[model samples]
Target: MADHRAALRAVVTQRMLTDPAHDLAHLDRVWLIAQTIADQRTNQRVLLAACYLHDLINLPKDDPNRHLASQQSATESEPILAELGFAASEICNTQHAIAAHSYSANIPPESPEACILRDADRLDALGAIGIARTFAVSGALGRALYDIADPFAEDRVLDDQKFAIDHWKTKLLNLPAEMVTDGGRDLAHKRVTQMLGFLEIFSEEIGHPLPINWKSV
Candidate 1:
């Protein structure tokens, strides 16, 4: 499996034009996380290809075409997969995994490999890494860290597009429930706990205590 990844890694590192949050390092992390959650029945080749190419067409969070990025990536990966000598069926599975991995894509993962890839990709959007990625993306887009008057959206709408921290409430905190595998859910819960802990200190640092409702998992 490691040898299989080496060639794909080179290709991804060479060709992917990406944002800080969706760089080669992000692909590597997704591969590692996918391994942890992958069961015996999982196909390593399909998972590896999907993880590396999932963000081949990385789009900004605010892109009107953001929801289509995954599908585009899936389409784009076909030639690469064929070039890499992947069987037709393997390529099909890999494409499905890539296409179904995005939250915005809203495609249900029907295959085990797709489910694992989706969970793995979503896992990267939580915990400490998730926090860093959120801020990186927000900073790139010139979004504020949080609403100064309502950091937790206590009285206002949750708008992650404007405030980086609101992403935690808008999507990140709820990812565990969206996980496909039991192991993925378990790990997501643990990561959410870590994020909540970070928020506790973050809230205090900003001179506002975390709301009691959000204090625990």
Candidate 2:
């Protein structure tokens, strides 16, 4: 069982590494956060495996078919797990967890492992790492940092963000409240506070008029 689990992890980790959107480091962060949150009542193996492999299907960052990609990834992951000698039940649970990880998909996690995986994935979107990913993804999609109109509009699609900074107001700032696990929520509170502080300071700096001596360097 242990060998099979290790082999499965290796395969998925490699896939994640090669995938641009949800890269290997994202998987590592999810596993780290999952480990911190998982308890005696939770299945660590299931949670970690799910966290690492949830985004195996490389969906376009702006694709409207987000749920379809998640479902496809979940469906494809089962065969890999079965080939790696995972039990049928374990494979099914992992598939469900993977399928439910995406927030835009809106599929609620049904098990403890799934909940932990969801929370861990969300935690990756919160603090310093979250900020980095937001910009990385935004830059990859050629989004600007701010738009004069509809800066905080929730109805605006992912492509509508003129800049990466606008994403904080659109989605990133709202993630903490949606987290599913207690540990995830705790970590999210600190990270959210950090993000809010950054935004406040940024606004103050941008709002103030530049001094005459402060020439462009």
Each model's number of backbone clashes? Answer: 0, 3
Candidate 2: pairs in clash: 144-162, 144-163, 145-163
Candidate 1, residues 1-217: lDDT per residue as tens digits?
A: 6766888888888888877999999999999999999999998889999999999898888999999999999999999999988999999999999999999999999899999999999999988899899899999999999999988999998998899998888788889999999889999999999999899899989998899867654
Kindly list the per-residue Cα lDDT of model 2 for residues 6-61, writing each as its tens digit. 67568877765354448877787788888898878876666766876788886776
Which candidate leads the pack in lDDT? 1
Model 2, global lDDT:
0.74
User: Which RMSD values do the candidates have, in order?
Assistant: 1.0, 6.2
For candidate 1, the lDDT comes to 0.92
The CA lDDT of each predicted structure is 0.92, 0.74
Give the per-residue Cα lDDT of candidate 2 at 123: 85
In model 2, what lDDT does residue 3 have?
A: 67
Q: Pick the candidate with the highest TM-score.
A: 1
